[model samples]
Structure formats: structure tokens, C-alpha cells
Target: MQFENTLSFAKSLDLKDELSDYRSQFHFPKVNNKPVVYFTGNSLGLQPKRTKKFVDEIMADWGDLAVEGHFHASKPWWDYHERLAEPLSHIVGAKKEEVCVMNTLTVNLHLLMVSFYRPTSKRFKILCEEKAFPSDQYMLQSQVRHHGFEPSEALVEVAKRDGEHYWRTEDILAKIEEIGDKLALVLIGGVNYYNGQVFDMQTITRAGKAVGANVGWDLAHAAGNIELELHEWEVDFAAWCSYKYMNSGPGNASGIFVHERHLKNDKLQRFEGWWGTKKDTRFLMKPEFESTHTADSWQLSNPPVLSLAPYLASLEMFDEVGMEKLIKKQKLIVAYLEFVLREIDKETEGSFEIITPADRGCQLSVFLHGQGRKLFDYLMENGVITDWREPNVIRLAPAPFYCSFEDMYRFGQILKSGIER
Candidate 1:
């Protein structure tokens, strides 16, 4: 399993890669007339070539049938969002009835919080990771304020230890225990957007539930990048955006998972609408709200078909490839990327500290010591599409669906040269 910083070695890996051929299925952007080495799938995935066909079908349906397209189109627009549930359930490891496509990531999180984040005099605090994504930070703050509590009093943050880039599992579990009866909810990003760390969700969920708290995950970065068993893990609820790693278009619709136990519960509080009514009687327009008896009950309105069209296209690929094969390639490819980064660091006498820990997915967040923004610009100008965070960390996420081992090799060459320059 030794890796070499050589083109031949990289090509050898590609020759043996079963997923290599799938790379051509996507459309990569060109820089200098060459397809760029894409490392931003954790930010926005490369578009699938098949996406145009899916989108075209929708456009054609709307043109040919107009309003009747809702019932007569190839995939029937009225129940269009339902088509996503089964395949998406497989990706997130949930039952079909427990998952559904709906609003965007933060919107779904807020809706889910309305149901899961019931605070009382005894149990009123929510525990989340410190420095969560800005959207998540805003969502939690607003939710707490809406419930008539100060964020300083109701939000409990588990911060990384001094000099640490990743969160410790023991610290999180201990924090849950410390919160004990006061903990109302534990919602965190399943894969940290900053460091690319995949938290021990199962362990953390168990600890949260044991402490009488509801546990959930924002899987925006975890959903397609890593293996998840949300159902088996007993996660109360979860949500994820489809753009990153999922290869849906930018800012596409999101998917949600509400545990089966909560599916038909009468006590759960959610903002509901007619689309969430049971399908058999939905057109009847009854005054009372009847739950769809699934995660679809969380929908506030009919889906935006244009956005869902691209997502449905992406899920088709996931159904074809399955998560098992994707994760198999992900592990090998990310390991090779780490090796290449180390090799470059040694060759250029550059101090590259990978902040992403062993518990990571496709992303490798490296702290580029003694280097500045010029190195990032050099790589970007040279056709390596990566992401730069504040400070000195650059997130390189070589999505296994399209990226080959040679990308790792070439990126190393770019890094070495950028440092030497």
C-alpha cells in the first residue's frame, strides 16, 4: 500500500481503479484548455453530464403538458419529490418513509428544530460544536431567541482543546454528561466543514439520548462523502444539502430524515401545509391537516421541480453506484492524497500540517505554514480547483466520483512548485 510521488505510480493506481471510468460522466471546468484537477466537490460538486437530460425532461414536460404535467408528465410533477425518498434513504441509511426531499439545508434544519428542540424549565440548553458553519450558527441563535432564551444561557458549545484542530470524542461525550438533565438538543455537523473531521455520530448520539436529549446531525458535508447509518445510529432527525459531494446543482433542495418513531407522533410540532397532507386526500382540500405519515409531512409546500430535477438526476447515480463502492474508493483516494501532501511538504521543505484528522472523508484541510495566499492563487491559476479558508488552511476535497489518483500526483507537483516559486 506504499504510495509514490510519481506519474507512473499514480497512473498505475488509476488503471486498477474501478471507478476511474465514471470520472468521464461529469463535466469539469477548463483552465488553460485542460480539465482542472477538481478538489472543491466538498464545496460544490462538478455537474454530471447526465444532468442536462434530466433537466431537459422537466422543461419539455412543462412545455408540452403545462399544468397537466403535474399528473401526466413522464415522472408526474405532483409527486416528483417522492421519487427521491428511496434512493436518498439508502444514502443516509434510513427507511424510505423516514426520509424526504424538501427545503434547503438551513431551512430544513430550522423546521426540524421546531419539532425536536422543545425546551422546558428543566431541560433548556442545546449543545453544538463551537464555530459551526455560519448558517448553522445563525439558525441556532435565531431558534433560541425565538424560544425566548438568550444564546449565552441556552447554547452550550463544545470547543476543541488548546492546540487541537479536531474535536475529541471523549470531550463531547463528557460535555453531554455534564449537561445531563439540562440538555434539550444535540445537533452538530456530521462532518465538520472547517477541518473535515467526521464526528463519532453514533457514540455522540448515544450519549445525548442517554442524557435525555434529542440528537441530530447537519449532514451537509457528510451525506455523500462518508458512510452513514442514521437509522441504525438512532438519530432522532437529520438534514443535508445536495450540492456538495451529492453532485446536485448549486443550492439545490435538501433531504431530511425523521426517525420512524417521530413520523406519526401527534405531539411533534412542525409548520405544516397542504402538501404535507396524505396524498390520498390531498386534492380534497380538507380544513384539517392530516399527516402524510412519513418525512414528507415536514414539507411546507410542493417542491421546486427545477431544483429537484437535478437532485433526482444525482440520486440516480448514487443508486447505481451505491455508497459501499464510493466509500471504498474514497478511503484509498484520500489516503493517497494525504501521502502526496506529505511528499510535497518534504520536497519543498514546506510545513504542511493537515488539520483534518484520521476521522475524515474526501477533504484534506492543510495548514500551509510559511506560505500565503499567493500559493493558493498559483494552484488555482494552474488549474487546481481547491478552497481556501481564512488563516492558512486550504481544503482539497478530491471527490472519488470524478477525481483520479493522478490528480493527487499533479496537485502535489503544483504545491511543490508553488512553494519553491
Candidate 2:
């Protein structure tokens, strides 16, 4: 397990990779007539080769049998959204009835908060990580304001220690105990988008439950990249976009999870639509809303077949290899990336620092001691696809699905040269 910088080390690791062949399954983008290294899957995944054909099938159905496509065509567009529940459930570690694929990530977050974030005089505060993704911050602020509570009074943001880059687990647990009485809900990201730190969902859920709080997760960065047992973890609800590690297309529909314990809980309220009504009598146009007895009761309208088709194709691929196998491979790749990053930092003598945690997921956020923007642009011009965060920090994600060990090594070589110049 010694860290080495030679190309031979990368080749040896690549040869031992079981999922190596899956790299060709994606349509990697090209630059100067060559495939880009594609370290940006943390933002948008590379498209699957089968994505076109998956959408084509639905397009053909719509073209050949316009109206019938809704009810009688192959896969039947009427119940198209239902077909994804099983695969989506498998990915998030939930029962089929407890999960539903619908809406975008932010939209689903808003909808889930509506049902899970009910506050009262005694318990009205929402606990979340400070510097959460902008959308999440906005969502939390608006939700608190909508409930007639001052955001400053109702939102408790957990921040990192003064000089530290990541929040400590002990501090978070202590905060839960300190304010458990006034807390109504805990809504935070499964993997921090900015720093790639993976939060302890199990401990967080346990802490929240002890304090009489409903808990939910925004899994935008964690769903496909890590192993999760949401059902066993007793998470009340969660939602995620599939475009990141899930390899679904950009702006793809997202998935949501609700614990089975809440399936019949009458206290839980939702913004209902006709699509969420009992399917057996949905076409009857009943005036009263009779929600389906599962997570599908949150659906607001019929799914877009084209969007869902690509997700179905991607989820099938996820089901084939399985999450455990994917995560095992990911740990190896990211560990290698971290090792190489450290080597570069040592070579530079404190010119840059890795802000992301060592035990983080695939991403590594590099903070340059000086100007990071120029270094990021230099790397991009040299054909490295790493992203630059504001002020400092270049985020590099050597994704498991398509990235090779050589990609990591090559990135290190280029990064060293970039910073030195």
C-alpha cells in the first residue's frame, strides 16, 4: 500500500480493476480530438452510451402511437414513473414503496421540508451546516420565514472550529444535545458539496431522534458515490439529484425517500396533486384527494418520459454493478488521488493545502497559498478539467466510473508543473 508516483503503479492498479471495462460505457467529451480526463463528474456526469437508445424507444412510441403511448405502449407512459421506484430504492437503501423518483433536487427538498419541518412554540428551530449549498440556504431561510419565524431565531448553523476547515463530529453531537429541546428538524447534505466531507448520517439521525426532531438529507453528492442504508439508519426522509455520481444527464429528475414508519402517519402533511391519488381510481376524477399509501403520494404530476428514460438506463447500470462494489473501488481510487495530492503538496513546500478531508468521498479541494484562479485556469489550458471554487481551492474529483489511475497521476504531474510556474 506504499504511495508511488510512477506510471507503472497506475498501470498495475488499473489491471487489477474489476470495473475497468465500464469506463467505455460512457460518452466522454473530447478536446483537441482526444477524450478529456473528465474530473468534473461531481458537477455533471458523463452521458451513458445507451442514453440515446433509451430515449429513442420512448420517442418511437410517441411517434408511432401518440395517444396510446400513454396507456398501451411498451413500458406504458401512464405508469412510467413507477418503473424506476425499484431501482431507485435499491440505490438509496429503501423499500420500493418508501422511495419515489420525481421532481428536481431543490424542488424535492422544498416539498420534503413542507412535510417534515412542522414547528411549534416549544420546538421551532432547524439545524443545518453553515455554508451549505446556496440553494439549501435559501430553502431553509424561506421555509423558516414562511412559518412565521425569524430565520435568525429559528435557524441554527453548525460551523467548523475557528481555524479548522471541517466541523468536528463531537461538536455536532454536543450541539444536538445543547439545543435538542428547541429543534424541530435536521436537514443537511449527506456529503458536503464544498469540501467533500461525508457526514455521519447514522449518528446524526440518532441524535436528531433523541431530541424529538424529524431528520432529512440532501444527498446530491452522496447517493451514487457512497454506501447508504437510509431505511436501516431510520432517516425520516431524504432527496437527491442523479446527475453527479449517478451518471444521469444534466437537469435529470431526482428521487425521494420516506421511512416506512411514516407511511400511515396521519400527522405528516404533503402538497398533493391528482397524480398522487390512488392509481386504481385516478382516471375517475374523484373530487376528494385520496393519497396513495406510500411515498408516491408526494408526486405532483406525470413524469417527463424523455428525462426519466435516461435515468432508467443509468439506474439499470447501477443495479448491475451494485453500490457496495462501486464504493469499494471508489475508496481505492480516491485514496490514491489523496496520496498523489499530498506528494505534490510536499514537493511544493506548503504552497498549497488540501481543504477536503482525507476520509472524504472522491473529491479533493486544493487551496493554493496564493492565487488559485490562475492555477486552475493554467491546469484547464493544459487539459486538466478540475473546477475552481471562489477565492481559492481547485476541486478535483477522480471519479470511479470512468477515471483511470493514470488520470490521477497525470493530474498530479500537471498540477505540480502549474503551481511551480
Candidate 3:
């Protein structure tokens, strides 16, 4: 379909949209009197209107019954995170038992490393994409250092070909094969945070396994945003924060996946804790940690009920819409967004350059080559909520659940005005 940079065309697309009604479900910030055009769901999602009800229920339970809420509350705080496993598994494409909600993203990565990142005398190197999210870069560096190896010696970064913005799948696989026996683990951000490129997870996992290296992904921008088959991909483990496309609150709980093959394996070493023990035996205060024979084995502490409340609220919506429908809408909406950017780029004398590749999710990281910080400031003042990086790049992520065609159209107009004026 040829897109026209007109309100009528955008409205026509919106009228035919099945997911458009979801826009009303979230609470958006207002500028003047109108709701801001929110494209920063990649950073933090808008609050769901239903989120308050879920949180209030937990607050009420705590008020009515202090310690007893663990067993007596409507949802029961003790088993609260369990309810999320089934619903969240649908979002990330994992079996219910293979997925678990736990600590923050980097923390979970460190914990999962205990099991998957075991380095030996021969295989001590870890391979990751160049310029991974700083937290992940730091995590890998610290892990390798803890094992008594210099990061320069143990960390192998696959830099992109000289001028390319995205990492080529062949380059990554070739690097994996080249690393060979020295490679202990292959961990990368599934959807790159900087360029919005979706890595070929299945193929990469295969190559890593063929090389006898454990494979994992930091799905911070992948889960709930892309089509993931973690279990079928035979992924050793994966972890994702819930705030981005998942629409959970800021710094909320993180979801994790550990393949079923490892669930029953007791020989693997991991950081064990109280909540990770068998559910029946959990309250008994047993001295020895007994595996629940599930991903719960990686859990270190009790579920944070207050934080999990918002996450579970957001996940209830995911369960209702399902990732299948979400992805269906994402493909069309993201394409439309890309089309709008191209149309605007032509109108503005090619001031915009999209760095995000075709294999992106909801985000489009555009380099404003001919534009500058003033334009970014204008966008902020004009109620277009977007994420900005240094060197004049704006990461616009129109989450399918709330973002509409009209938002894209309006953004194009705002962008044109920002460029010309």
C-alpha cells in the first residue's frame, strides 16, 4: 500500500485496525490538553489503567492481613510469581515450567552465568556482539574477571564490518566457529538496543551448540517485541526485563527461561536459594536446596509482591491479546512507521537516516544527520515522547498495543516541521 502523508489516510488505517482500541487502555502523559505522542515504550511503557486495580488488591491484602497474606490473600503472595509463568511463557515462546519471573535483568544474567557460563582451562572465552548494552558489557567483563582471566583475553567481541550498523548473521556464526573450543558461551542481546536489529537466535544457538558452547540471550528488547522460540531454539537460558514492550512498570520484575533439558540436571552448578527449593518443601526451612526441577531453580529469593503486582497486571493483557496477534499487528504497524519515516526523509531533503535494519521489532533508530539537539528539544516540547542518543539519534518505538497509524502520521508532520523550521 502506498502511504500518503495525510490525516485521512492515517485515520482510514486506524478505522480498520482491530488493536486500535488498546490505545485507550493505557494512561498517556498530557502536553497542553492533549495526550503526548508516546514512542518510548522501548525505554519504559505507559501505565495500564488496569494496573492500579491489581496493585490496590495487594495493598488491601497487606493492610487486612500482614503476614497471613502470604497464604490467605486472594492471589496469595507466596505463589504469586507462579501465576505469571503460564501467561508469560506464551509471550516469550517457552513451556510454562521453563519460564520463571525473578530478579532484574543484569542480576539474572549473573545468576544464570553460574550454570551456563562455566569456563574451563581450555574454553574460557565468552563471545558477545560489539557495543552490547553497557550493563551486559560490564556483566560479562566482571564474570570473566571473577574466573581469574583478563577481559582482553577472555572476552571476544564480534565487531560489525567497518561501516555497517548491524551485525551480519554470517559474521556472528563465523566468529563462533573461529572461536571454536576456546568459546565457553555465546551471549548477546537478541534485539540490539542500539540499532534495533534482531539477531538470528536459532541459527546462532545452533552454531554455539555445535561448537560445544552454551548459548543464551539477553532479551531485554526481544521478549514481547519479537517472535521468539526460546525452547524450540534449544536456548540454554534467556532473561528479559518487563518494562519495555512488555508494558510493566519501571524497573519491574524480569522473566527468565531455562531449557527443559537442564531442568532435571542436578549436576549443573547454580546459585541456590530458599525460594528455588521444592514448593512443598519450601516452607519446611530445609537446610539443603532441593530443585523444583524447573526454571525456579535459578530463583534466589521470594517474589517481590509489590513489583510483581504491576508486572502481573501487564502480563494479563498479554495473555488476553496473545503474542501471535501482537506480532501480526507489529509487522504492519512497524512497516507503516518505516514508510512514514522514509516519506518524511524525502520531504526534508534526507535529513533522517534510519540505522535500524529490516529485521527490527517496534523500534526505528534514526540518525538525524542533518538535524541536531535543537530538533530533539523541539520534539520534546511538542509532546513527541522519544528516546534520544548522543550524536543526534532518536529511537522511536511505537508499541503495537497503544501506538496507532495516526501517531506515525502526526510524528512525520512534527518531524518535517522540526527539520524545515
Q: How many residue pairs clash (N, CA or C atoms closer than 3 angstroms) in each of the candidate models, in the order given?
A: 0, 0, 0
Q: How good is model 2 by TM-score?
A: 0.98
The segments of candidate 1 whose C-alpha lies over 4 angstroms from its true place after superposition are none
Write one digit per residue (lDDT tens) for candidate 1, span 1-421: 9888899999999999988888999998999999999999999999999999999999999999999999999999999998999999899999999999998999999999999999998899999999999999999999999999999999999999999999999999999999899999999999999999999999999999998999999999999989999999999999999999999999999999999999989779999999999999999999999998899999989889999999999899999999999999999999999999888888777667899999999889999897879899999999999999999889999999999999899989988888999
Q: What is the lDDT of residue 419 in candidate 3?
A: 91
Tens digit per residue, CA lDDT, model 3, 189-221: 999998899999999999999989999999999
Each prediction's TM-score against the native?
0.99, 0.98, 0.99
Cα RMSD for candidate 2? 1.2
Clashing pairs in 1: none
Better candidate by TM-score, 2 or 3: 3
Best by lDDT: 1
Quote the lDDT for 206 in model 1: 96
Q: Rank the candidates by lDDT, best first.
A: 1, 3, 2
Which residue ranges in model 2 land beyond 4 Å of their true spot?
none
Local distance difference test, each candidate: 0.94, 0.88, 0.92
Residue 266 displacement in candidate 2 (angstroms): 3.5
Whole-model lDDT, model 1:
0.94
